[model samples]
Target: MERVEPMPLGGDVARRADAHAAAPLLNCLIREVAQRCPGQGGRRVYRLPGGGRLLRVREGRRPADPEVYTAGAWQRVGHTDLVKLVAEELRRHTGLSNDELPAEMIDSRDAVAALLAARDRVAPPADPYLRSEQSLVTGHPYHPAPKARGGGPVASWLAYAPEAHARFPLVLLAVREDALVEEGDTAALDALGQAPPGYRLLPAHPWQLDLVGGDLAGAFADGRLLRLGTTAFDVWPTAAVRTVHAPAADPAPGADLFLKFSLDVRITNDVRRLWRHDLLKLRRTDTAAAGAIEAQDGPAAWLSDRGYRTAAFAFEELAVLVRDGLGGHVLPGATPLLAAALAEGFDGNPLDGPADPAVWWEAYLRQVVPPVLNAFARHGVVLEAHLQNSLVAVDTGGIPVQALFRDAEGVKLLPDVTRAAGWERLVYCLVVNHLTEVAAALVERHPDHDPWPAARREFARHDVPEIPRLLTSPTLPGKTNLLLRWTGADGADARYLPLPNPLSGP
Candidate 1:
């Protein structure tokens, strides 16, 4: 008779020990497993028997696997039951109650080893996928029951993975209508099997279309089809509306408008409400204040006060849904500012640096600032004024003449919340978030100038003077980052109100 060798503890037990250290729940599970199978390999190393200490467990066969086992099977132990078993075992072995183990012991490696030993005894759970109803819904043909469609000589439709679900499987099928042999046979759903001569079916990658089948359909219907690349889109609604390009054919054109959905609905709603409330407050109380400031100072102050406004458009208002054109104008691509610079470039690169402040100043005075300011003053609203949110379109002279504010959802009103909260939020969004990023980009282009200080001083002199004092001075009840930092012109800092910088050309 052949003798069965005793199973030695597996290497996987150590790995599980390490993993359980990082996860509290896993530790509890291990303890439970040990309690259930007390005879299974279980060992604790206090001091080493040899030169180096070793924690080891003797191998034990599980009833389910018998000879070989997997880590996944061990992980299926119920957490609560595991805890109870470990407590009972501790009482029997140490003559102490379940609660007697120090809190530290629960997190220790020794406890983890004990738990793994216990898990070795329990049988793993049955595969959940085996229980699903759609097991027959394989890469099969879309054959409706007899009453639904043509039964004989039906066309073939290809089924592709639409999305992957750990729990539920889904597939996308593009039925080619042109492939149908029967004419005027709308009722023959099964007639369309294969793709037609001129038509093709394109299915999204499983990873790309994962959790967004409904959203994708809605976007296609609404014609708002720009979406982020796989990585970015998965985490946030940061898509650029554009057409996809095909290698062999002419470039697919895209739309001028872009839409970004909110990842967190609460955050989106908060921003929208904030904008509305600020607009109401500004229209009622700040109109005169803005006008007076503009008159006393200049166009820069005036435009800064007005900001950007939001308009709800009817579906008919949209022009063509140009397919992938936005790829050319995306950020770090051919931005409006860069386009203008290239048109006026002294060298080949558009971002060789502005030729003169006059060109920049004129554009700001004539085009960029005024409309934005006028919009806010007239309509009592402001769009996101941050660097990334606002696009700078230049003209032939390499001057920033136009500003296109994207991400309509990030737009908010000025001076609506309590003074302190409003100022902090505005500064954080505008100066810290937007301006800092833009400054960094410009600095990358213009290595010679300490762009940050210059921009800070310029902002102080032209837009908001009080920023310097706010950053450098003692913290007021709610004031933050107002006096100490160079508000963006240079060294000269002064106390001033919150306003857009005049010289911030685009």
Candidate 2:
């Protein structure tokens, strides 16, 4: 066996030593050992050519023996090569270098692959209740009935009872074969046995059906239509859908929970577009768009299933219709907290007293930034930490406590496939997209505060305590292009901030 010597752990030698420095050497050693051993799981301690030992750790959870080497045994190894090896693997996998990474981690190659695979295989959900032309004329017979008490008579002969309420204008019952009904319509009320005194029935318009698109199966599967009492509300339909009041008393205990869909598909579309763009930028062009979709959705669903504070909805497609309603009824004082901060605008200062730069900085560092950093460190995921994308939920006293991070479409695995692409994008989103925007807003609001310096100090103190390099980093102009555009600045005046490379331990 070729003997290897572990480096000494003091002075300049210790400073240069890292887990990764040992990876190439360990990898070579492991290959040699595997050739000799040919086993699924095993551990061996070998004395190196140097005065140290190599403790090989092999895990057999998978078909092949996954091996890692720690240079220790005789004396406690202060600078284990395993750290560098893992760090390198992390960089290869997520794009973040060791300095940009979190303090802890949950490593599972299969889990990571599964998540990546899931992003590519997302199919739009289905809605079983929708009416198709072929089904309307052929499978189910449609019987037209006289419009109810307050409503006009049905205009189409094909309108049926259970589905009759699918038409619009609940009060008039103006029958259009395809007109869609609101969740709180009288026809739905009648089905629920809670019809109001002046309830009316209506037929759906044909044009409305055309707007609903083809198969309802996908919509239903995707959670677009949910049952409320006896009526089904269009939860995530593509078009602009609205909710109206029904005269009946609340049916379910939690009936007060109003479910409104989103109007702009841009949020979801942006997520998909960004995800694909990032993947392509990282040179993972071989991975299909389906892969990206699956990767994004899998973690989203996982997080939702695990009960994180995500915007309460199912798919990105559903976000269009649901977000507005969710936004409307956000816990009463929550909007004001966010609005107060956003109203200040985005500039280059951070010390505006009216906005309490200290308070904002503290809250963000202690509460907001930690969770996000922790998530990345522990899970290899960088959440969408942008201002507009995040919701600041506060208590009745107006003190910000909990942060509601929405738009899962933006959450990505750090240390993405390639080194440069993943790291740059992660830095762009975290530092530029989220942090810089907020910093600019703070600075704009408080012109005298010198926002950049304060922000650097704050980030250094909390997010990357090990690396103080952020404090001395120069500004990047082109990088802050988004902020400049938002600030309505032209060319020369916009100040861009450049972040220091993390590894140097600034």
Candidate 3:
């Protein structure tokens, strides 16, 4: 749900869109297929193994300004040409023609262009939390097509896209008590509206309802279901597009509550659905994470996926997950911002301020690292603690006082995954995928600073057996999302590559 993406664009917006799109694409090419070619001056050169052609790009967090050496000199390639070059290179590299990935690359770029065009039109909510949710445009920095919305027309998904800063009410549905199948405490749903006798309230994402509405026509006609109209208050969609933050009802003073619904369409990878299997196991995993965090010493908390409700007939399609929101979990006087939002900045980012780097970085390490390691070592629970799943609540001085983690669907128990496999996932999600991005953002702002040494010390202080090896390892495993997508591997089945260890060296 979170990737380093081009922000709401300005200047020559077309060129901005091209660069933004090309950065992740170029990164994918270099990481998955291209071999490095040394001595290319200010730009780095890589050999496309498929064509044996030399290509160059100015490298940064997001590689940019790409060129291909042709006709005795380097010639720049725009996003269009870059896509063609990547296709040809991949053909030679993998010995397979991937018509799908290439189209997705183009689709991602086009989506960015569309988002750029629409960003200014929709007014972002006054709430900073909502702003962070919609801040990502360059999604999944390593993903080739982070913004490809199932290749549908821009108009199809634009109204629901978080990047567009769109907000709307959920469509209310009343399923007959006989038809409603639910587990856990879904009291939050009943609070949304009153249900007629013999029926229960089920709030659905309007976009998802639009996607699966036709299938439910029979139920509506047969009177098994009834429409209670839309909710009076609008809910802001978060980075995980299907999950929304619904503001508390007026006259009730409390924190916002989160509602996640099944989305049939694919976003980055998997179809966004609350699958039946995951729902069955949700309570155990949520209990593990919740207990682990509660047992810890600090203010760290786990936003439990308290329970789920779904129609018995269309289980996965109609499933809705209720999760705890920021109200009670976040430390008082501290504003909790998405870790992804901190990495991919937004208006009023605490990181974009005057906080001392060492102190801020140390506090961040303390808040984020301990709970993850503790969860894995103490409770044998592996949290997908990547940036999108993390929240850092910063005090008035913009110092992190607590960390809140969510999404039980992504949680893997010790025995569910081999301890070895779970450890790998925890390292990837917590260190490579989450901390590295945050550290890089800090360094980018500080210029001459190195935040990784403190990171090394943080891990070294942990008593877990994995810490020493992690600190000394020559490389850390980084997810190869582009290659994973190209190979059509399940997104949950992560494939990794050895990236140079920043924690071990300068």
In TM-score terms, which candidate is top?
3
Model 2 stretches astray by more than 4 angstroms? 1-355, 395-399, 414-420, 462-472, 475-506
Candidate 1 stretches with Cα past 4 Å from truth are 1-209, 212-255, 261-349, 353-382, 414-416, 444-447, 450-506
lDDT of 1: 0.29
- Candidates sorted by lDDT, best first: 3, 2, 1
Q: What is the lDDT of residue 231 in candidate 2?
A: 36
Superposed by TM-score, candidate 3 places the C-alpha of residue 145 at a distance from the truth, in angstroms, of 0.7
Worst 10 residues of 2 by lDDT: 137-146
lDDT score at residue 25, model 1, on the 0-100 scale: 26
Residue-level lDDT of model 1, residues 1-506, one tens digit each, is 11111233467865554333323322222222222232334522121122221212322210111111234333232323333433444455434453412222232333333334433543211211111111111101100010111111111101110001111111222323232121111221111133234432222223224323454565446533323222111110111101111111212221122222111111100211213333333333334433433443222222122221221221111111111123333333222431122211223332454665434434443433343434444444454454334445545555554544443333445555344444454454445434443443344555554444444344444344345654453322211111112112221212333333322332
lDDT values, one for every candidate: 0.29, 0.30, 0.84
lDDT (10s digit) by residue, model 3, range 113-218 = 8787777566666777778888998877777878887787777778788888887777989999999999998988887778899999998888788788899999
Question: Which ten-residue region of model 3 has the weakest summed lDDT?
Answer: 1-10
TM-score quality measure for candidate 1: 0.31
Residues 1-506 of candidate 2: C-alpha lDDT, one tens digit per residue: 11111222343332322221222223333322222333323544443322233344332111112233434322333223343443444344334444411111111111112222222232222221111100111000000001111121222211211112222221212111122222211222223233222332221222222223253345335543321232332222111112222211333221222122212211111111112222223222212221332343111111111111101222212221111223233444442222213322212112233456656655544444555545554445555555434444444433445554443434556455343343445455556545654554555555565544444555566454322533444532124332222233443232434443322223
For all the candidates, what are their Cα RMSDs to the real structure?
22.8, 25.5, 3.2
